[model samples]
Target: MFEQLGLIGCGLMGGSFALAMKKAGLVKRVVGYSKSPSTTDRARQLGVIDVEAPSALLAVAGADIVLVAVPVAATEATLKAIRHLVTPNMLIMDVGSTKADVVQAARRALRDQVGSFVPAHPITGREVSGVEHADAELYTGRQVILTPMDRTLPEQFAKAETVWNALGCRVSNMSPESHDAAFAAVSHLPHLLAFAMMNSITGQAEGDDFLSLAGPGFRDFTRIAASDPKVWRDILLSNREELLAQSRLFQQTLQNIEQAMQKGDTQALEDMITLASETRAHWRMGAQRTSKGR
Candidate 1:
Protein backbone atom coordinates (compact mmCIF):
# COMPACT_ATOMS: atom_id res chain seq x y z
CA MET A 1 0.00 0.00 0.00
CA PHE A 2 1.10 3.55 -0.68
CA GLU A 3 1.70 5.86 2.28
CA GLN A 4 -0.13 8.71 0.61
CA LEU A 5 -1.52 9.81 -2.73
CA GLY A 6 -0.74 13.42 -3.57
CA LEU A 7 -3.55 14.40 -5.89
CA ILE A 8 -3.40 17.61 -7.93
CA GLY A 9 -6.41 19.12 -9.73
CA CYS A 10 -9.04 17.37 -7.57
CA GLY A 11 -11.76 17.32 -10.22
CA LEU A 12 -13.54 14.36 -11.76
CA MET A 13 -10.42 12.50 -12.87
CA GLY A 14 -8.33 13.26 -9.81
CA GLY A 15 -11.15 12.71 -7.33
CA SER A 16 -12.12 9.51 -9.07
CA PHE A 17 -8.57 8.24 -8.88
CA ALA A 18 -8.42 9.08 -5.18
CA LEU A 19 -11.72 7.28 -4.61
CA ALA A 20 -10.59 4.28 -6.65
CA MET A 21 -7.35 4.03 -4.72
CA LYS A 22 -9.28 4.25 -1.50
CA LYS A 23 -11.77 1.64 -2.62
CA ALA A 24 -8.94 -0.68 -3.61
CA GLY A 25 -7.17 -0.08 -0.28
CA LEU A 26 -4.10 1.02 -2.18
CA VAL A 27 -3.32 4.20 -0.24
CA LYS A 28 -3.45 5.24 3.40
CA ARG A 29 -4.29 8.90 2.78
CA VAL A 30 -4.91 11.33 -0.05
CA VAL A 31 -3.89 14.99 0.02
CA GLY A 32 -5.42 16.98 -2.80
CA TYR A 33 -4.94 20.47 -4.28
CA SER A 34 -6.76 22.39 -6.96
CA LYS A 35 -6.51 25.85 -8.47
CA SER A 36 -9.85 26.63 -6.83
CA PRO A 37 -9.88 26.39 -3.06
CA SER A 38 -13.60 25.64 -3.11
CA THR A 39 -12.98 22.64 -5.36
CA THR A 40 -10.34 21.30 -2.99
CA ASP A 41 -12.73 21.85 -0.09
CA ARG A 42 -15.54 20.07 -1.90
CA ALA A 43 -13.28 17.15 -2.68
CA ARG A 44 -12.35 16.82 0.97
CA GLN A 45 -15.96 17.19 2.08
CA LEU A 46 -16.92 14.50 -0.39
CA GLY A 47 -14.27 12.25 1.19
CA VAL A 48 -12.38 12.08 -2.04
CA ILE A 49 -9.31 13.28 -0.21
CA ASP A 50 -8.21 13.19 3.40
CA VAL A 51 -6.32 16.47 3.40
CA GLU A 52 -6.44 19.76 1.51
CA ALA A 53 -3.28 21.37 0.20
CA PRO A 54 -3.01 25.06 -0.59
CA SER A 55 -0.62 24.55 -3.47
CA ALA A 56 0.49 21.80 -5.83
CA LEU A 57 3.93 21.66 -4.24
CA LEU A 58 2.48 21.16 -0.78
CA ALA A 59 0.26 18.40 -2.07
CA VAL A 60 3.32 16.39 -3.04
CA ALA A 61 5.03 16.98 0.31
CA GLY A 62 4.61 13.62 2.14
CA ALA A 63 2.98 11.62 -0.57
CA ASP A 64 4.47 8.52 -2.13
CA ILE A 65 2.33 8.59 -5.29
CA VAL A 66 1.17 11.66 -7.20
CA LEU A 67 -1.49 12.02 -9.87
CA VAL A 68 -1.58 15.17 -11.95
CA ALA A 69 -5.07 15.35 -13.43
CA VAL A 70 -5.09 18.94 -14.60
CA PRO A 71 -5.98 20.14 -18.11
CA VAL A 72 -3.33 19.45 -20.74
CA ALA A 73 -2.54 23.17 -21.07
CA ALA A 74 -1.76 23.47 -17.35
CA THR A 75 0.35 20.30 -17.07
CA GLU A 76 3.74 21.96 -17.39
CA ALA A 77 3.02 24.58 -14.75
CA THR A 78 1.54 21.97 -12.40
CA LEU A 79 4.57 19.70 -12.78
CA LYS A 80 6.91 22.62 -12.28
CA ALA A 81 5.06 23.47 -9.08
CA ILE A 82 5.75 20.04 -7.63
CA ARG A 83 9.16 19.42 -9.24
CA HIS A 84 11.11 20.58 -6.18
CA LEU A 85 9.67 17.73 -4.11
CA VAL A 86 9.66 15.02 -6.80
CA THR A 87 11.87 12.15 -5.68
CA PRO A 88 13.27 9.20 -7.63
CA ASN A 89 11.14 6.78 -5.63
CA MET A 90 7.86 8.62 -6.09
CA LEU A 91 5.59 7.39 -8.88
CA ILE A 92 4.06 10.32 -10.79
CA MET A 93 1.51 9.99 -13.54
CA ASP A 94 -0.88 12.27 -15.46
CA VAL A 95 -4.32 11.62 -16.93
CA GLY A 96 -3.84 13.93 -19.90
CA SER A 97 -5.33 12.65 -23.18
CA THR A 98 -2.57 13.98 -25.38
CA LYS A 99 0.67 12.15 -24.70
CA ALA A 100 3.45 13.77 -26.74
CA ASP A 101 2.68 17.26 -25.46
CA VAL A 102 2.43 16.01 -21.87
CA VAL A 103 5.72 14.15 -22.24
CA GLN A 104 7.37 17.32 -23.50
CA ALA A 105 5.90 19.26 -20.58
CA ALA A 106 7.21 16.67 -18.12
CA ARG A 107 10.70 16.87 -19.59
CA ARG A 108 10.75 20.65 -19.32
CA ALA A 109 9.28 20.82 -15.83
CA LEU A 110 10.74 17.75 -14.12
CA ARG A 111 14.10 17.70 -16.01
CA ASP A 112 16.15 14.81 -14.52
CA GLN A 113 13.22 13.74 -12.37
CA VAL A 114 11.22 13.12 -15.56
CA GLY A 115 12.11 9.46 -15.17
CA SER A 116 9.59 9.29 -12.32
CA PHE A 117 6.81 10.70 -14.51
CA VAL A 118 4.69 8.39 -16.65
CA PRO A 119 2.28 9.89 -19.17
CA ALA A 120 -1.10 8.09 -19.10
CA HIS A 121 -4.51 8.47 -20.73
CA PRO A 122 -7.47 6.51 -19.44
CA ILE A 123 -9.95 5.94 -22.28
CA THR A 124 -13.09 6.78 -20.37
CA GLY A 125 -15.09 9.70 -18.97
CA ARG A 126 -18.58 11.10 -18.81
CA GLU A 127 -19.81 14.28 -20.50
CA VAL A 128 -20.20 15.99 -17.13
CA SER A 129 -17.15 16.91 -15.04
CA GLY A 130 -16.68 17.92 -11.38
CA VAL A 131 -15.56 16.59 -8.05
CA GLU A 132 -19.21 15.85 -7.33
CA HIS A 133 -19.34 13.61 -10.38
CA ALA A 134 -16.36 11.58 -9.36
CA ASP A 135 -16.97 7.82 -9.28
CA ALA A 136 -14.69 5.13 -8.00
CA GLU A 137 -15.65 2.85 -10.91
CA LEU A 138 -14.60 5.39 -13.56
CA TYR A 139 -11.50 3.47 -14.52
CA THR A 140 -12.93 0.00 -14.07
CA GLY A 141 -12.65 -2.11 -17.21
CA ARG A 142 -11.33 0.93 -19.07
CA GLN A 143 -8.41 0.93 -21.47
CA VAL A 144 -5.53 2.96 -20.03
CA ILE A 145 -2.73 3.86 -22.39
CA LEU A 146 0.70 4.55 -20.89
CA THR A 147 3.22 6.51 -22.92
CA PRO A 148 6.43 6.30 -20.95
CA MET A 149 9.29 8.49 -22.10
CA ASP A 150 12.76 7.17 -22.95
CA ARG A 151 14.03 8.58 -19.67
CA THR A 152 11.31 6.91 -17.64
CA LEU A 153 12.54 4.55 -14.93
CA PRO A 154 11.67 0.90 -15.48
CA GLU A 155 10.46 0.35 -11.94
CA GLN A 156 8.22 3.41 -12.01
CA PHE A 157 6.73 2.35 -15.35
CA ALA A 158 6.09 -1.13 -13.97
CA LYS A 159 4.45 0.36 -10.89
CA ALA A 160 2.16 2.51 -13.05
CA GLU A 161 1.01 -0.53 -14.99
CA THR A 162 0.46 -2.48 -11.79
CA VAL A 163 -1.57 0.32 -10.24
CA TRP A 164 -3.88 0.66 -13.21
CA ASN A 165 -4.21 -3.09 -13.59
CA ALA A 166 -5.17 -3.42 -9.94
CA LEU A 167 -7.91 -0.85 -10.57
CA GLY A 168 -9.45 -3.24 -13.19
CA CYS A 169 -7.97 -1.36 -16.14
CA ARG A 170 -6.62 -3.00 -19.28
CA VAL A 171 -3.22 -1.33 -19.49
CA SER A 172 -1.30 -0.93 -22.75
CA ASN A 173 1.95 0.81 -23.60
CA MET A 174 2.80 2.90 -26.66
CA SER A 175 5.32 5.57 -27.67
CA PRO A 176 4.10 9.12 -27.04
CA GLU A 177 4.16 10.00 -30.75
CA SER A 178 2.14 6.94 -31.72
CA HIS A 179 -0.26 7.50 -28.84
CA ASP A 180 -0.90 11.10 -29.94
CA ALA A 181 -1.43 10.19 -33.58
CA ALA A 182 -3.79 7.28 -32.86
CA PHE A 183 -5.89 9.16 -30.32
CA ALA A 184 -6.02 12.20 -32.60
CA ALA A 185 -7.84 10.09 -35.17
CA VAL A 186 -10.03 8.10 -32.80
CA SER A 187 -10.87 10.43 -29.92
CA HIS A 188 -10.00 14.05 -30.75
CA LEU A 189 -11.35 14.12 -34.30
CA PRO A 190 -14.63 12.48 -33.24
CA HIS A 191 -15.21 15.12 -30.58
CA LEU A 192 -14.40 17.83 -33.11
CA LEU A 193 -16.96 16.40 -35.53
CA ALA A 194 -19.60 16.18 -32.85
CA PHE A 195 -18.95 19.82 -31.90
CA ALA A 196 -19.08 20.91 -35.53
CA MET A 197 -22.24 18.92 -36.25
CA MET A 198 -24.06 20.60 -33.38
CA ASN A 199 -22.90 24.05 -34.50
CA SER A 200 -23.78 23.39 -38.14
CA ILE A 201 -27.40 22.67 -37.26
CA THR A 202 -27.74 25.40 -34.62
CA GLY A 203 -26.23 28.11 -36.80
CA GLN A 204 -29.14 27.79 -39.27
CA ALA A 205 -32.39 29.78 -39.18
CA GLU A 206 -34.36 26.61 -38.46
CA GLY A 207 -31.84 25.39 -35.90
CA ASP A 208 -34.22 25.15 -32.96
CA ASP A 209 -36.85 23.52 -35.13
CA PHE A 210 -34.36 20.92 -36.31
CA LEU A 211 -33.25 20.18 -32.79
CA SER A 212 -36.84 19.87 -31.63
CA LEU A 213 -37.39 17.13 -34.18
CA ALA A 214 -34.08 15.34 -33.54
CA GLY A 215 -34.49 11.71 -32.53
CA PRO A 216 -32.26 9.13 -30.89
CA GLY A 217 -29.73 9.04 -33.73
CA PHE A 218 -29.15 12.78 -33.61
CA ARG A 219 -28.93 12.75 -29.84
CA ASP A 220 -26.45 9.86 -29.89
CA PHE A 221 -24.31 11.51 -32.54
CA THR A 222 -24.19 14.92 -30.84
CA ARG A 223 -23.95 13.74 -27.25
CA ILE A 224 -20.20 14.40 -27.11
CA ALA A 225 -20.81 18.04 -28.05
CA ALA A 226 -22.05 18.53 -24.49
CA SER A 227 -18.63 17.57 -23.05
CA ASP A 228 -16.72 20.07 -20.93
CA PRO A 229 -15.77 22.87 -23.34
CA LYS A 230 -12.50 23.98 -21.75
CA VAL A 231 -11.18 20.42 -21.47
CA TRP A 232 -11.89 19.56 -25.12
CA ARG A 233 -10.63 22.96 -26.30
CA ASP A 234 -7.24 22.20 -24.80
CA ILE A 235 -7.22 18.66 -26.17
CA LEU A 236 -8.06 19.79 -29.71
CA LEU A 237 -5.48 22.58 -29.67
CA SER A 238 -2.75 20.42 -28.13
CA ASN A 239 -3.05 17.78 -30.86
CA ARG A 240 -4.17 20.02 -33.71
CA GLU A 241 -1.60 18.80 -36.24
CA GLU A 242 -2.68 15.16 -36.07
CA LEU A 243 -6.35 16.07 -35.57
CA LEU A 244 -6.27 18.32 -38.63
CA ALA A 245 -4.74 15.53 -40.70
CA GLN A 246 -7.55 13.21 -39.65
CA SER A 247 -10.10 15.93 -40.41
CA ARG A 248 -8.77 16.23 -43.94
CA LEU A 249 -9.11 12.49 -44.47
CA PHE A 250 -12.68 12.55 -43.15
CA GLN A 251 -13.53 15.46 -45.43
CA GLN A 252 -12.23 13.55 -48.45
CA THR A 253 -14.45 10.55 -47.71
CA LEU A 254 -17.43 12.82 -47.09
CA GLN A 255 -16.84 14.58 -50.40
CA ASN A 256 -16.75 11.28 -52.26
CA ILE A 257 -20.17 10.32 -50.86
CA GLU A 258 -21.53 13.78 -51.60
CA GLN A 259 -20.32 13.55 -55.21
CA ALA A 260 -22.04 10.22 -55.70
CA MET A 261 -25.26 11.69 -54.33
CA GLN A 262 -25.03 14.74 -56.60
CA LYS A 263 -24.41 12.58 -59.69
CA GLY A 264 -27.37 10.28 -58.83
CA ASP A 265 -24.95 7.32 -58.86
CA THR A 266 -27.09 4.96 -56.82
CA GLN A 267 -24.77 1.98 -57.33
CA ALA A 268 -21.67 3.97 -56.31
CA LEU A 269 -23.36 5.29 -53.17
CA GLU A 270 -24.68 1.82 -52.30
CA ASP A 271 -21.21 0.32 -52.79
CA MET A 272 -19.61 2.92 -50.51
CA ILE A 273 -22.29 2.50 -47.83
CA THR A 274 -21.98 -1.26 -47.99
CA LEU A 275 -18.21 -1.09 -47.52
CA ALA A 276 -18.57 1.23 -44.49
CA SER A 277 -21.30 -0.91 -42.98
CA GLU A 278 -19.27 -4.10 -43.35
CA THR A 279 -16.15 -2.48 -41.91
CA ARG A 280 -18.04 -1.21 -38.88
CA ALA A 281 -19.72 -4.56 -38.33
CA HIS A 282 -16.41 -6.43 -38.56
CA TRP A 283 -14.75 -4.01 -36.16
CA ARG A 284 -17.57 -4.37 -33.64
CA MET A 285 -17.31 -8.16 -33.75
CA GLY A 286 -13.54 -8.03 -33.27
CA ALA A 287 -13.94 -5.65 -30.35
CA GLN A 288 -16.48 -7.95 -28.73
CA ARG A 289 -14.13 -10.91 -29.11
CA THR A 290 -11.27 -9.00 -27.56
CA SER A 291 -13.44 -7.82 -24.66
CA LYS A 292 -14.63 -11.35 -24.02
CA GLY A 293 -11.08 -12.66 -24.07
CA ARG A 294 -10.00 -10.00 -21.58
Candidate 2:
Protein backbone atom coordinates (compact mmCIF):
# COMPACT_ATOMS: atom_id res chain seq x y z
CA MET A 1 0.00 0.00 0.00
CA PHE A 2 3.09 2.21 0.28
CA GLU A 3 5.00 3.78 -2.59
CA GLN A 4 8.42 2.70 -1.32
CA LEU A 5 9.41 -0.46 0.59
CA GLY A 6 12.86 -1.43 1.83
CA LEU A 7 14.11 -4.90 2.61
CA ILE A 8 17.45 -4.76 4.49
CA GLY A 9 18.44 -8.42 4.09
CA CYS A 10 17.51 -10.56 1.11
CA GLY A 11 17.70 -13.82 2.98
CA LEU A 12 14.82 -16.17 3.81
CA MET A 13 12.47 -13.78 5.63
CA GLY A 14 13.35 -10.70 3.58
CA GLY A 15 13.25 -12.59 0.32
CA SER A 16 9.92 -14.12 1.25
CA PHE A 17 8.49 -10.69 2.00
CA ALA A 18 9.51 -9.52 -1.44
CA LEU A 19 7.84 -12.49 -3.06
CA ALA A 20 4.71 -11.90 -1.01
CA MET A 21 4.50 -8.26 -1.97
CA LYS A 22 5.08 -8.97 -5.66
CA LYS A 23 2.43 -11.67 -5.79
CA ALA A 24 -0.13 -9.66 -3.81
CA GLY A 25 0.38 -6.53 -5.94
CA LEU A 26 0.44 -4.36 -2.85
CA VAL A 27 3.61 -2.45 -3.65
CA LYS A 28 4.72 -0.76 -6.87
CA ARG A 29 8.33 -0.32 -5.76
CA VAL A 30 10.65 -2.39 -3.55
CA VAL A 31 14.33 -1.70 -2.83
CA GLY A 32 16.47 -4.54 -1.52
CA TYR A 33 19.92 -4.69 0.13
CA SER A 34 22.21 -7.46 1.29
CA LYS A 35 25.83 -7.77 2.34
CA SER A 36 26.03 -10.96 0.32
CA PRO A 37 26.13 -10.24 -3.39
CA SER A 38 25.10 -13.78 -4.24
CA THR A 39 21.92 -13.48 -2.19
CA THR A 40 21.06 -10.08 -3.70
CA ASP A 41 21.59 -11.48 -7.18
CA ARG A 42 19.48 -14.53 -6.41
CA ALA A 43 16.61 -12.45 -5.06
CA ARG A 44 16.73 -10.32 -8.22
CA GLN A 45 16.61 -13.44 -10.38
CA LEU A 46 13.54 -14.59 -8.47
CA GLY A 47 11.78 -11.34 -9.43
CA VAL A 48 11.41 -10.53 -5.77
CA ILE A 49 12.34 -6.85 -6.09
CA ASP A 50 12.81 -4.02 -8.59
CA VAL A 51 16.17 -2.64 -7.45
CA GLU A 52 19.16 -3.56 -5.25
CA ALA A 53 21.22 -1.05 -3.27
CA PRO A 54 24.92 -0.92 -2.41
CA SER A 55 24.39 -0.21 1.29
CA ALA A 56 21.72 -0.53 4.00
CA LEU A 57 21.05 3.20 3.94
CA LEU A 58 20.58 3.29 0.17
CA ALA A 59 17.95 0.59 0.54
CA VAL A 60 16.13 2.24 3.43
CA ALA A 61 16.41 5.96 2.64
CA GLY A 62 12.92 7.41 2.07
CA ALA A 63 11.22 4.02 1.93
CA ASP A 64 7.77 3.99 3.52
CA ILE A 65 8.46 0.64 5.19
CA VAL A 66 11.73 -1.03 6.15
CA LEU A 67 12.00 -4.60 7.34
CA VAL A 68 15.25 -5.51 9.09
CA ALA A 69 15.48 -9.26 8.62
CA VAL A 70 18.80 -10.39 10.00
CA PRO A 71 20.31 -12.42 12.82
CA VAL A 72 19.09 -11.19 16.22
CA ALA A 73 22.58 -10.09 17.28
CA ALA A 74 23.10 -8.21 14.02
CA THR A 75 19.83 -6.26 14.34
CA GLU A 76 21.28 -3.40 16.37
CA ALA A 77 24.18 -2.98 13.98
CA THR A 78 21.77 -2.76 11.06
CA LEU A 79 19.58 -0.29 12.93
CA LYS A 80 22.59 1.83 13.88
CA ALA A 81 23.74 1.87 10.29
CA ILE A 82 20.37 3.06 8.97
CA ARG A 83 18.91 4.97 11.91
CA HIS A 84 19.91 8.41 10.61
CA LEU A 85 18.52 7.67 7.17
CA VAL A 86 15.10 6.55 8.39
CA THR A 87 12.43 9.23 8.34
CA PRO A 88 9.53 9.53 10.74
CA ASN A 89 7.14 8.35 8.04
CA MET A 90 9.03 5.12 7.49
CA LEU A 91 7.53 2.16 9.33
CA ILE A 92 10.34 0.01 10.79
CA MET A 93 9.83 -3.64 11.58
CA ASP A 94 11.89 -6.78 12.12
CA VAL A 95 11.27 -10.50 11.85
CA GLY A 96 13.38 -11.45 14.85
CA SER A 97 12.80 -14.54 16.95
CA THR A 98 13.91 -12.59 20.01
CA LYS A 99 12.04 -9.31 20.62
CA ALA A 100 13.21 -7.62 23.83
CA ASP A 101 16.76 -7.02 22.67
CA VAL A 102 15.70 -5.85 19.24
CA VAL A 103 13.14 -3.40 20.62
CA GLN A 104 15.63 -2.00 23.11
CA ALA A 105 18.30 -1.67 20.45
CA ALA A 106 15.97 0.20 18.12
CA ARG A 107 14.95 2.53 20.96
CA ARG A 108 18.59 3.29 21.72
CA ALA A 109 19.37 4.02 18.12
CA LEU A 110 16.22 5.81 16.92
CA ARG A 111 15.05 7.60 20.09
CA ASP A 112 12.06 9.68 18.88
CA GLN A 113 11.90 7.77 15.59
CA VAL A 114 11.08 4.72 17.69
CA GLY A 115 7.48 5.89 17.73
CA SER A 116 7.24 4.99 14.03
CA PHE A 117 8.83 1.58 14.59
CA VAL A 118 6.94 -1.67 14.94
CA PRO A 119 8.69 -4.64 16.52
CA ALA A 120 7.23 -7.76 14.91
CA HIS A 121 7.92 -11.49 14.78
CA PRO A 122 6.22 -13.79 12.33
CA ILE A 123 5.63 -17.27 13.77
CA THR A 124 6.22 -18.84 10.36
CA GLY A 125 9.58 -19.93 8.95
CA ARG A 126 11.15 -22.90 7.22
CA GLU A 127 13.96 -25.07 8.55
CA VAL A 128 15.76 -24.37 5.28
CA SER A 129 16.55 -20.77 4.21
CA GLY A 130 17.63 -18.54 1.32
CA VAL A 131 15.93 -16.60 -1.47
CA GLU A 132 15.60 -19.79 -3.51
CA HIS A 133 13.37 -21.28 -0.80
CA ALA A 134 11.33 -18.10 -0.54
CA ASP A 135 7.59 -18.48 -1.05
CA ALA A 136 4.96 -15.78 -1.35
CA GLU A 137 2.41 -17.89 0.54
CA LEU A 138 4.66 -18.38 3.58
CA TYR A 139 2.78 -15.68 5.48
CA THR A 140 -0.72 -16.51 4.28
CA GLY A 141 -2.99 -17.33 7.21
CA ARG A 142 -0.01 -17.05 9.56
CA GLN A 143 0.13 -15.28 12.88
CA VAL A 144 2.43 -12.21 13.00
CA ILE A 145 3.11 -10.95 16.54
CA LEU A 146 3.62 -7.19 16.84
CA THR A 147 5.36 -5.92 19.98
CA PRO A 148 4.46 -2.22 19.91
CA MET A 149 4.74 -0.64 23.33
CA ASP A 150 3.09 2.60 24.57
CA ARG A 151 5.45 4.95 22.77
CA THR A 152 4.31 3.71 19.33
CA LEU A 153 1.48 5.87 18.00
CA PRO A 154 -1.84 4.30 17.00
CA GLU A 155 -1.52 5.49 13.38
CA GLN A 156 1.92 3.97 12.99
CA PHE A 157 0.75 0.74 14.57
CA ALA A 158 -2.23 0.67 12.20
CA LYS A 159 0.09 1.10 9.21
CA ALA A 160 2.10 -1.93 10.34
CA GLU A 161 -1.08 -3.98 10.76
CA THR A 162 -2.40 -2.93 7.35
CA VAL A 163 0.75 -4.07 5.57
CA TRP A 164 0.71 -7.48 7.26
CA ASN A 165 -3.02 -7.96 6.77
CA ALA A 166 -2.67 -7.18 3.08
CA LEU A 167 -0.19 -10.04 2.96
CA GLY A 168 -2.87 -12.35 4.42
CA CYS A 169 -1.52 -12.52 7.94
CA ARG A 170 -3.51 -12.27 11.18
CA VAL A 171 -2.07 -9.64 13.52
CA SER A 172 -1.75 -9.98 17.29
CA ASN A 173 -0.05 -7.33 19.40
CA MET A 174 2.15 -8.24 22.38
CA SER A 175 4.64 -6.48 24.60
CA PRO A 176 8.33 -6.95 23.77
CA GLU A 177 9.07 -8.35 27.24
CA SER A 178 6.21 -10.83 26.99
CA HIS A 179 7.16 -11.91 23.46
CA ASP A 180 10.76 -12.73 24.47
CA ALA A 181 9.71 -14.56 27.64
CA ALA A 182 7.13 -16.72 25.84
CA PHE A 183 9.26 -17.56 22.81
CA ALA A 184 12.11 -18.48 25.15
CA ALA A 185 9.93 -21.18 26.68
CA VAL A 186 8.08 -22.42 23.61
CA SER A 187 10.39 -21.78 20.63
CA HIS A 188 13.96 -21.07 21.79
CA LEU A 189 14.13 -23.62 24.62
CA PRO A 190 12.71 -26.43 22.48
CA HIS A 191 15.24 -25.77 19.70
CA LEU A 192 18.12 -25.80 22.19
CA LEU A 193 16.92 -29.00 23.78
CA ALA A 194 16.58 -30.70 20.41
CA PHE A 195 20.12 -29.73 19.49
CA ALA A 196 21.38 -30.96 22.85
CA MET A 197 19.53 -34.25 22.61
CA MET A 198 20.80 -34.95 19.13
CA ASN A 199 24.33 -33.98 20.09
CA SER A 200 24.23 -36.03 23.27
CA ILE A 201 24.10 -39.30 21.33
CA THR A 202 25.54 -38.04 18.06
CA GLY A 203 28.63 -36.64 19.74
CA GLN A 204 29.57 -40.07 20.99
CA ALA A 205 32.45 -42.07 19.44
CA GLU A 206 30.15 -43.67 16.86
CA GLY A 207 28.31 -40.50 16.01
CA ASP A 208 27.62 -41.39 12.39
CA ASP A 209 26.51 -44.88 13.30
CA PHE A 210 24.22 -43.49 16.01
CA LEU A 211 22.71 -41.10 13.49
CA SER A 212 22.19 -43.94 11.01
CA LEU A 213 20.45 -45.95 13.72
CA ALA A 214 18.07 -43.15 14.63
CA GLY A 215 14.40 -44.02 14.21
CA PRO A 216 11.59 -41.70 13.11
CA GLY A 217 11.04 -40.50 16.69
CA PHE A 218 14.66 -39.38 16.93
CA ARG A 219 14.48 -37.91 13.47
CA ASP A 220 11.42 -35.82 14.29
CA PHE A 221 12.78 -34.63 17.63
CA THR A 222 16.07 -33.44 16.13
CA ARG A 223 14.78 -31.87 12.92
CA ILE A 224 14.89 -28.28 14.32
CA ALA A 225 18.47 -28.86 15.50
CA ALA A 226 19.49 -28.77 11.85
CA SER A 227 18.41 -25.12 11.40
CA ASP A 228 21.05 -22.48 10.63
CA PRO A 229 23.51 -22.46 13.53
CA LYS A 230 24.46 -18.79 13.20
CA VAL A 231 20.83 -17.69 13.48
CA TRP A 232 20.23 -20.08 16.36
CA ARG A 233 23.37 -18.89 18.14
CA ASP A 234 22.29 -15.25 17.82
CA ILE A 235 18.80 -15.99 19.13
CA LEU A 236 20.26 -18.00 22.00
CA LEU A 237 22.49 -15.17 23.13
CA SER A 238 19.63 -12.65 22.87
CA ASN A 239 17.24 -14.75 24.96
CA ARG A 240 19.69 -16.56 27.22
CA GLU A 241 17.98 -15.64 30.49
CA GLU A 242 14.59 -17.12 29.65
CA LEU A 243 16.17 -20.09 27.90
CA LEU A 244 18.19 -20.87 31.02
CA ALA A 245 15.03 -21.06 33.06
CA GLN A 246 13.47 -23.39 30.51
CA SER A 247 16.59 -25.57 30.59
CA ARG A 248 16.35 -25.80 34.37
CA LEU A 249 12.76 -26.92 34.11
CA PHE A 250 13.74 -29.61 31.64
CA GLN A 251 16.53 -30.77 33.96
CA GLN A 252 14.07 -30.98 36.86
CA THR A 253 11.64 -32.99 34.74
CA LEU A 254 14.41 -35.37 33.79
CA GLN A 255 15.28 -35.74 37.48
CA ASN A 256 11.69 -36.57 38.33
CA ILE A 257 11.60 -39.24 35.65
CA GLU A 258 14.87 -40.66 36.94
CA GLN A 259 13.48 -40.87 40.43
CA ALA A 260 10.33 -42.58 39.20
CA MET A 261 12.31 -45.12 37.20
CA GLN A 262 14.65 -45.83 40.12
CA LYS A 263 11.67 -46.43 42.37
CA GLY A 264 10.02 -48.66 39.71
CA ASP A 265 6.98 -46.38 39.74
CA THR A 266 5.49 -47.44 36.40
CA GLN A 267 2.26 -45.56 37.04
CA ALA A 268 4.08 -42.28 37.59
CA LEU A 269 6.17 -42.67 34.42
CA GLU A 270 3.16 -43.64 32.31
CA ASP A 271 1.16 -40.75 33.71
CA MET A 272 3.86 -38.30 32.72
CA ILE A 273 4.07 -39.79 29.24
CA THR A 274 0.30 -39.62 28.81
CA LEU A 275 0.15 -36.04 29.92
CA ALA A 276 2.88 -35.01 27.49
CA SER A 277 1.14 -36.88 24.67
CA GLU A 278 -2.22 -35.17 25.31
CA THR A 279 -0.73 -31.70 25.53
CA ARG A 280 1.24 -32.20 22.32
CA ALA A 281 -1.89 -33.42 20.54
CA HIS A 282 -3.77 -30.28 21.47
CA TRP A 283 -1.00 -27.95 20.39
CA ARG A 284 -0.47 -29.86 17.15
CA MET A 285 -4.15 -29.48 16.31
CA GLY A 286 -4.00 -25.79 17.07
CA ALA A 287 -1.07 -25.37 14.71
CA GLN A 288 -3.04 -27.28 12.09
CA ARG A 289 -5.74 -24.62 12.21
CA THR A 290 -3.29 -22.05 10.88
CA SER A 291 -1.86 -24.41 8.26
CA LYS A 292 -5.25 -25.55 7.09
CA GLY A 293 -6.45 -21.97 6.86
CA ARG A 294 -3.77 -21.52 4.24
**Candidate with the greatest TM-score versus the true structure:** 1
Q: What's the TM for model 1?
A: 0.96
lDDT of 2 at 18: 79
> What is the C-alpha local distance difference test score of each model?
0.92, 0.84
**Model 1 ranges with Cα > 4 A deviation:** 285-294
Candidate 2 lDDT tens digits, 129-160: 78888889988878888998678877878888
Candidate topping lDDT: 1
Displacement of the residue 37 alpha carbon in candidate 2, Å: 1.9
lDDT of 1 by residue, 1-294 (tens): 799999999888999999999999999999999999999999999999999999999999999899999999999999999999999999999999999889999999999999999899998888889999999999998888888888899989889988998999988788889889998988899899999989999999999998999999988878788888888989999999999999999999999999999999999999999999988777741144232211
> Backbone collision count in every prediction?
0, 0
